[model samples]
Target: MKTTGSPAGTGETAGSEANGAGGAPLRLWGGRFAGGPAEALAKLSVSVHFDWRLAPYDLLASKAHARVLYRAELLDDAELAAMLGALDDVGADVAAGRFTATIEDEDVHTALERALVERLGTLGGKLRAGRSRNDQVATDLRLYLRAAVRQVAAVLTELSEALVDVAEEHVATPAPGMTHLQHAQPISFGHQILAHVHAFARDVDRLRDWDRRAAVCALGAGALAGSSLPLDPEGVAAELGFDRAFANSIDAVSDRDFAAEFLFAAAMIGVHLSRLGEEIVLWTSREFGWVELDDAFATGSSIMPQKKNPDVGELARGKSGRLIGALTGLLATLKGLPLAYDRDLQEDKEPVFDAVDTLLVVLPAVTGTVATMKVRTERVAAAAPDGFSLATDVAEYLVRRGVPFRSAHEAVGALVAWCVEHDADLGEVSDAQLAAINPAFTPDVRDVLSVAGALDARSAPGGTAPARVREQIANLRPTLAADHKWAVG
Candidate 1:
């Protein structure tokens, strides 16, 4: 494998300076080997393609390590300055898409190390002292994921705020709430939207909690044991914005619980998004007609001239399976691994990257769907009281009239059964029919049978009443604002 030097450099390639006797690019580890690795084995072992996304993080870790080397008296001030300059060049090249990993570069660390050596000669070589690819990759991954967590959180906050805005617009619009796919009661459309907002609020909390555990640095845990040099792990951790260094050297490089936790949070987000997507799909359908998807967020069919499909919602619903699969597959990868780093651990990044990337694309589309969609207030309100949705209100009415709740429930159940047999609506059920079931009935029972009455009756702290929903929205604004500040900051 040959090192490809960038045109900006002095044309002195890493291979020209550090190639093995056989002319293969110098491997960071291969002194003990009799010959270069087989072509198939090298190809199979390389991760530079996917892991190259970690280049910026790898550069940060390298800079930190360089400082540690300088502090330990391993590198002089000039060498440290030169190495830092070369690392900056490499980062710039990477950021500008000029630097890329080759097949010879086994992973991100190797690629960046090769680039640094190409730029600054031996000064670049000194950057790897007292550091192993094991801990280096671990540190890089942690840094990458920490930033990713914040990015995802920020987007999630956006989605939550989108939901809040929509909820505010529809605070008094009636919609049917469901249980087992049956109309359970009437609730404000605002309240239904807030249910999703509340779920995302919990997701934001989970991300914050996960960040605390993820902030432990892995840079000093060199190859599953503490580094021999006088390296300041605490300083490196602090420099990289970590809370602390890992307690155990072996645990530091091996710990992937943070990754799993992120995936879990992501998966839970997928689940919540899928629920919203499912509802969007349902609501946009002609059968339900509760909402209309915006043209920008929806698509038209190829053959059907009149088709307007909620493809964004459909994809969100479909992609949740992919998120769950990524989580399960990652868990499987981590299940039987022994202590410390292994090549198998290389499998971790792509799955999580895929999950996070999937969410990155899915979230904004779903947010736009929610933000731009037109809620059909008349249709939702019309459907709000259908399918015996007022039966619970009827039962509650009897309960308020001094009847036992169980008896009230039984009376309402029988009345509902009667209505079902006669194909009659709850509002159409006469006072005679109500009194036949229970003496608790009066003409006043009809007051509770209306959808608006049903919505206002339940005014407890988390109920679907308009006033309570408004209070919930007001209370959630501060929390969302605080979390958004933290996420963006």
Candidate 2:
């Protein structure tokens, strides 16, 4: 279950063309202006460094848009053939590290268009007629996220299965359930881990729903209006595998609702992972000692020789903040901006890119940490009934024996208080002490005191009872398998 990754911009590798500073400042739209952009503006506006990752997506949209242009008679048969040839060559060069963004290239769209112009002379410039970078970038981003969602989903499924693996093995195992960090009751260990699995399952469902709602193509929404040219937006949309072409051109180019939605989903996944990480941190602690992390997943302090740190869990907990920042930061960038398209939109990509990148790396580590951790069953079982956790069971027992509910509650509270005052274990209380606390406390009250009895007593569906927990684990398996297939397909 080993995993690896680099940061957002530092991928598997960067091409040589990716490293060079612009030989001279280049502006994509300089016809209206007398001169190139100022160095300061260029410095501020430059995005090719990070946006180069979108080259393939930009090229994909370009090819689709070219077909739209050709069908509209904007390009003759020979010219269309030549243009597509040039595009394919440029795509190959980009893939093989032969072509890439230099500082002079304003962005992916500009860089790739420059390559076309270099390859086919005037024939290359023909493809840019009906589209604006506004629409082009919007389309490219959708394409990127459309594919990236699957990757996120794939890893999400992996993490989910890891949790299920742990839960399946621990169905009948006892553990303390808490409210406000105080032991509240007894629960099956499997039930607790399955709770996390359910949260992640919702995240998977979210990504799928978001993908469907966001499958809109933006290519025909040139700038913020429909183009006068006889373009087939629907045809292009089909070619790009979008559900449909966007209905409103203005909303199409200006809308980053999809990006915002994606960030929200990614952030939610991070929050759930962080929760699991936090529990792992607590479980592995000296006080808890209920779980032990694998040596590969755990770390040690440099100076403190005896320190065995749950670094995976701690980092997983910490990265949730970063994922949240990406969401909130994107939301802030999106707020109050007048629409059709603005430079602020450029701010959308990096954060969303980073959120996905962070999750891709973090999820695998957390999954490995969880899947390999050694559970101390004796410790967990012993701790399950501590803190008079079975007090609720005692109350329930009294209720079943025809005692009034209020009277039962009072009797159990007194029994717990008596145990605390005497520094005596709750299980060690006698029938005489039970009768003294409240006549409802019969010898049979102790029947429900054992951890197994407490756990099995919760026999309702979705309860922590062993049989019910096993049912949940069984049902989750097929969903996990389907989610993996959907993610990969």
Candidate 3:
């Protein structure tokens, strides 16, 4: 490569700069100008490094657009066939790493056009007639993100199933449920794990809902004005598997709402994983002593011979901030842009790609973590009854035995105060102490004070009682199956 530019810092013009003997910059846009873009602008304008990930999607759109060109008589039958063949070859080479974008190529669209031109000569140049990189890139991203959304959704399914399996295996396992970081009640351990599963189910649902909005094709919205050629945008949309063609050309090219929505969904998935990770970290801690990580999932510290760190859980927690930053960064990039596309729109792909990449890697590791971790049931059961967690059951039991709810609540509060003052467990109060607390605190209150009694007392639908937990799983499996089917679609 050769170039003559206003020197790097001299502020001279490089309008006539050439990067090759032919004096062209190996770009798609130089024909309109005498020389090339300034080296500074050229270097800054290049997006192939990140946008190259869109190469396969770009080529797919190009193939669809070529058919549109042929139908419009812009290209003859033989030309369309040649164009499709060239695109297929380029796709294969790209997949195999034999063909790749160069920095001078500017972006995926340009680099791909360069490939086509090299393969088919002037026949390739004919392919660009009724489209612009604005529409092409927009369409490519929709295609790419739609697929990425499904990929993320599928992995979410994996994590969700991992959680469901754990839930089923431990439906009878008792654990302390907390509010404000303090023990609130005893709940089925399965119930706690299934709660995470439900959050991930919503993530999959969010992606599916987003896909409906993102399924429109943007190809014929060339450069933000509808193409003037006899274009069958709807036909092209059908060919490309889009739900429909763009109704508004400007909106089509400039709308990054889909990308933002996806990052939001990805960020939310990160948040759910962070919460699950947070709990995993807590459970595996010596202070909690409720869970132990599988050897493969736990990490050893360099200096501490006894360290078994929850590195995977910690990474899941930390990466949530990264995912959220991707969403916010795109919103900032998009906030001031007017109708139609701008170079700032070029910033969209990296965040979208990174979020997709991040989740695909994170979900599998977290799934493995959930699937393999060991719960210390004895410790969990012991902790279940600590901190006066059974107090709520005592209050409910009083309510059932003809005590006014508020009076029963007061009676239970005094009993708890007595227990706290005397350093006694809720179940340790004898009938003499019950009479001392209140007459409503009958001898039978001791029955509900048991951990299993506290768990089974709330046996209505959606309760943590073992039977209800099993029923919940029975209902949840079909929903997960439906979710998996929709996600893979």
| Top candidate, metric TM-score | 1
Cα lDDT tens digits, model 2, 191-223, are 999999999999999999999988999998999
TM-score quality measure for candidate 2: 0.94
The TM-scores, one per candidate, come to: 0.96, 0.94, 0.94
User: Which model is ahead, 1 or 3, in terms of lDDT?
Assistant: 1
- Against the reference, the lDDT scores of all candidates come to 0.87, 0.86, 0.86
Of the candidates numbered 1 and 3, which has the greater TM-score value?
A: 1
Give the count of colliding residue pairs in each prediction. 0, 0, 0
Worst 10 residues of 1 by lDDT: 1-10
Q: What RMSD does each model have against the real structure?
A: 2.1, 6.2, 5.7
For candidate 1, lDDT tens digit of each residue in 1-489?
A: 333344224444455545556677758898798888899999999988899889999999889989999999999877788778788878888888787878787888877877887776655678888889889888988899989888899899999999999999998999989989888899999999999999999999999999999999988889998888999999999999999988999999888888888899999999999999999999999999889988899899899999999998899989999989888988999999999788888988998899889999999999999999999999999999888998999888788778899998898888889889999998887888778866777778888878888888889999999999999999999999999999888
Model 1 accuracy (lDDT, Cα): 0.87
For model 3 the local lDDT of residue 295 reads 94
After the best TM-score superposition of candidate 3, give how far the Cα of residue 281 lies from its true spot, in angstroms. 0.3
- The C-alpha stretches of model 3 lying farther than 4 A from their native spots are 1-21
